[model samples]
Target chain A: MPYSETAREEQPRTPSLTIDALGKKCPIPIIWLAQRIGEVPLNAVVAVLADDPAAYTDVPAWCRLKSHPHVGTYELPEGGWSIHVRRNY
Target chain B: MLSAVEHSAVLHAAGVHERDGGAVSAVGVSRTGAVRVDAFAEAVAVPGTALACLQTANHEVGTLQPVAEVAAACREAGVPLLVDAAQTAGRLPLPEGWSVLTASAHKWGGPPGVGVLVVRKGTRFRSPLPEDEREGRRVPGFENVPAIVAAAAALRAGLAEEHEQERLSALVDRIRRTVPRVVPDVEVIGEDEDRAPHIVTFSCLYVAGEALLTELDKAGFAVSSGSSCTASTLRPSHVLEAMGVLTHGNIRVSLPRGASAADVDRFLEVLPGIVRRIRQEAGVSS
Candidate 1:
């Protein structure tokens, strides 16, 4: 409940799952990604749309901890980022 | 030492301990940013431990550690305890049972580069440098006589004006309670009570800490930040991270002696707008 609500976003990468944490805060964006990572199948690309400064680092750190491949992070036209992660089961 | 939130001084001291072939133990910190004193007692009780060090109070979050209890634990375990009272010296009473204590002069409104190191009677200590006649051979260099006298005067003056502390404490309390209500999506780092009177810290959600700091500075608020974006390390300060608190957009406000109530109120007034502006620039809706 502390985290902001999530929505889906369309990215050029066409991730299988998109977690929208656009206006959310630090650990919340990280929380959204961790909570919804299981929704997509293994090896699926999950895109996290976040603008939180902390999420820029936390997302990659979370991926490293979970052993998921952090594919890449791309800038968005609307001032945030789209981080693509490949969940490696 | 409590590694989770110690100032870098202790961290580097830990490095020295390792080089000296002594195993240094760290106590975990609670989410409120205080060290786990019970675990620290156990760590001190470990066999072959030579000395344990603890801070009089946490510098970042202003939370006071249970130094007396910890020092007692170290004593019972037969380990000498060093209390780093840099932040609380002259501001608060000294904690009991410390074998050695250290303080910084500038921290108490005195000239910089003057430090106070006191070893309690019967405490075994030797200068790492070659023995000298200066200060009972504990210090190697010639002491700065004027600076030391000025530092003592400043400390005495600070302790004399103890009533000013109540006013500063109130101001800090105002910041602690009002920051969240005024600025949307703000998380105050430490508790309202049981903290150093002069300090308060908070983090704004979705706002870059440096950006916030710049705006606040432009508005005449000279504050410090612990957020990773503000530092060259490119990582959040270990204190906030260890406590699992918001690490970005963090601001630490330390009121100087005789800080005004009107200034604090104005800070509360302008903070929301600053946070909003930063969030907007970041494309955050809130």
Candidate 2:
């Protein structure tokens, strides 16, 4: 088995997730956030951090399209943002 | 046009030392085709000085900088001016009051490695480094005689085509107007009233500049991004950063001489899909 597969199997299952998409531009942050959500168990909570100015629009749109429920969004003082998504499985 | 000896004599008469005081600073234009004056000012230490450095004759945004205004400023400050006419030297008449002008011959159909630097009478300049006995006191080293001859010939030929600039500028304007109509989520940069007439930049909302350039290259359109100078280090453009604009998925299109309307139309037709595909891959929507 690949090292990645072995590492995944050894890792403990968690209901909470974090996606650090800071410093990523545009669709990259949203796409990365979406992929991370896909890997979480049903009803899992995923938090995404993005620094792109467009993230205010992109993140919410992504949550809508992926059917993941948006928990909330908060603004970061350091010119970034945080979005919370709840995976619907 | 003075002969080689006359050119040397002119510099000598102007107190431009062949070895020491004949050097002029040069700066490279950004990928967006915009020239950054602050960088040049830093490099040459021209701040609050009488010395002026010229920007691209035609800016990357296709607008020409007010070289004459810069020259006037230098004059008011009692400083000489140097014009780096890389983008416009051979193609257009140089603005008045340019004391020293440098240009790459290849930009005007001449061979590479051949550069021309002209010093007007009474300009104070110095040679860059230690050197002796060469083409004038301004440039020291054995002359690439063949390249120089070719550059001169190319200059004359290019000057003959000055009339064509208006036509090409019009075509670029057309493309500038058409691109935004077709591509969504794009904000065209540098539409200032004083912008250049041959280059334009637009940033897609969700695409990365590198990915867009790669896709365009693969599709046979030679476009550029206003991002990093080299691959592997992905950073947004400093020009856009200065302007406080978004830098994602930026494309700078510089139309070469003789570029036709059909070519611009084709590029416009193909460009939106490229942006769309990249956005899709990145999972961004309009």
Candidate 3:
């Protein structure tokens, strides 16, 4: 168990932060993400949880415009999505 | 100057800038979102107050404004009052003393894409935009003649059905009464009487409004919600917020023309289970 734990800990993973934009409408999630992207360390992933449909496209588009890489999106079980964007800057 | 109960659209028209930190002196509203008359009187009485505008009735909760009183106040103050009657136009009679009245056709079952703007005679209004021939050069564009005809026809039909208004009002009453009783921890907004006939809004505790709305849609009923999660921006409704009501799991049931009693009954019947299931899913306690 110790060996397995050590091996698991050795594997590199992208650092991630969550911005709970759930229950917030469209531009809000984007705005919150924009405001807080600097809080995370460089190359870290920022996941914005939002339910607004506009954010599904807007977040990635914003990342593209801002020149950050959109990592991916994951659906939350309750509702909405956690849109992951990489802080390239 | 403006009323606290004014719609966002009106605020934009007035150029009451939200961005760049611009502000307008605004009148206040009662807990029920009714404009405070004394406060309105004060706001409009200020110097350089170009025009005073208000809605005949609020679109969200069906709360009717004191238009005649406000109109009288405006008249006494020599201020022009622009009444947005989009919600009240076909369903109710317009109160006298508005300098300008505006309405949308779609609100009254008319064709979408058609609107009416009436400037009372001797109002001394200048067109904000440059010259055009159509709409007396007030609105410059090629007229949508087909939509105009359809809108007029729909308005005529809507007005002819005065009895139908009362019927829909009764149906609305049923939902207003039944929703709170059926669903736990619900607050029905708007006055019991003295509200527009067709629209009823309510908020449910411990339920995510968008979830409830989606569940209802799956169950073959369509409704609107004011919950932040429900809106595209995920922002809670300004109307409900202004009314000082619960902002969560809010639902606005707008009974369309020709909707039956059974339809409302089905909605009331289905709503409780939907809320309960959602609460259970979200682990919200009773």
Candidate 4:
């Protein structure tokens, strides 16, 4: 209840799942991505939209620590980074 | 050294024990920002405890620590107590019963780079610096007399401005009362009863502290933020973390000496919209 939930209803064409972590801070974005990675099939991409400064480093670090392949990050129009990671586990 | 902000020097000093193969155990504060005396006792009771340090008040939240009670316990336990008065030197009366005391000049409207370290008589503190005759051989460098003079003058002037201090304190109270009401998802930190008058910290949800600071800076207002994201290291403030408050999107408003009520009003008028804009840009609806 402390974090604001703003799920993006738009469906991506790349068979990827988008998590609206736009307003969430550090650990929350990574936690959400980690917990919900199972929602997408194995090897599918999970994208996190986060504006928190810590996410710029933490997201990649989480992927590296968990041994997932980092798909790359794209700049979002709303002033945050859209980070993608493949569910290698 | 309960926090990394104002009392970083104390923390660094404690690190010396670890470097010498001794361990340093720190006791944290409760949600109200008050450290328990029993915890202090526990930390001191640890075998081979050399010294203990505590801040008189937290720089970020301005919550007063229960220092006197802890000091009494430390004395009975034969542990030297170092009191860091950085946030309380000029703002509040100095707490008694400290074996050693350290304070910064700039925190009390004095010249920067002038700091005070007092060792109570007969405390038997050995000087780490090489032997020198300056300042009774305690500090090795040449005394910065001019800065020390300016620092003393500033302290005198700040102490003499009691009337203006009261007026500005009222202005701070107004901001404390109005910010939460006008801005949603804000958690105002510190205890109202035992807080410094000039400082107020609050965290706004769904906003990046850096963006909010930039907006306020463009709007001709300058304030500090505790959000570690704004700092070079990108770590949250230890003070706010210890208080268990929101670490992101935190703002510290420290009213300058002789700050006027009109200035505070202008800041309050601009803050809500700036927070809203930042939240909106972050794609947060609330």
Query: Which model is ahead, 1 or 4, in terms of lDDT?
Result: 1
How well docked is model 3, in DockQ terms?
A: 0.02
- Give the number of the best model, judged by DockQ: 1
Task: For candidate 1, give the lDDT of residue B198.
Answer: 93
Clashing residue pairs, candidate 3?
A24-B234, A25-B233, A25-B234, A26-B233
Clashes of 3: 4
Name the better of 1 and 4 by DockQ: 1
Best by TM-score: 1
lDDT values, one for every candidate: 0.79, 0.62, 0.76, 0.76
lDDT of 4 by residue, B140-209 (tens): 9788899999999999999988776577668878988999999986778787768777888887765667
Residue B26 displacement in candidate 3 (angstroms): 2.4
What is the fnat score of candidate 4? 0.02
Off by over 4 Å in 1: A1-89, B227-230
Q: Candidate 3 has what TM-score?
A: 0.74
Candidate 1 backbone clash number? 0
Candidate 2 C-alpha lDDT tens digits along A1-89: 01111122222223388888888776687667755677877877787788875555456545544567666666779878776777887
Fraction of native contacts (fnat) of each candidate: 0.07, 0.14, 0.00, 0.02
Give the per-residue Cα lDDT of candidate 1 at B108.
97
Clashing pairs in 4: none
lDDT tens digits by residue: candidate 4, A44-86: 9898899985666556645654667666766788798887778
**Tens digits of lDDT, candidate 1, B23-81:** 76677777678887888999888888877888887888899988888888888999899
lDDT of 2 at B258: 78
Give per-residue CA lDDT, model 3, range B43-99, as digits (tens): 888876778888987777888898888898898889999999987889989878899
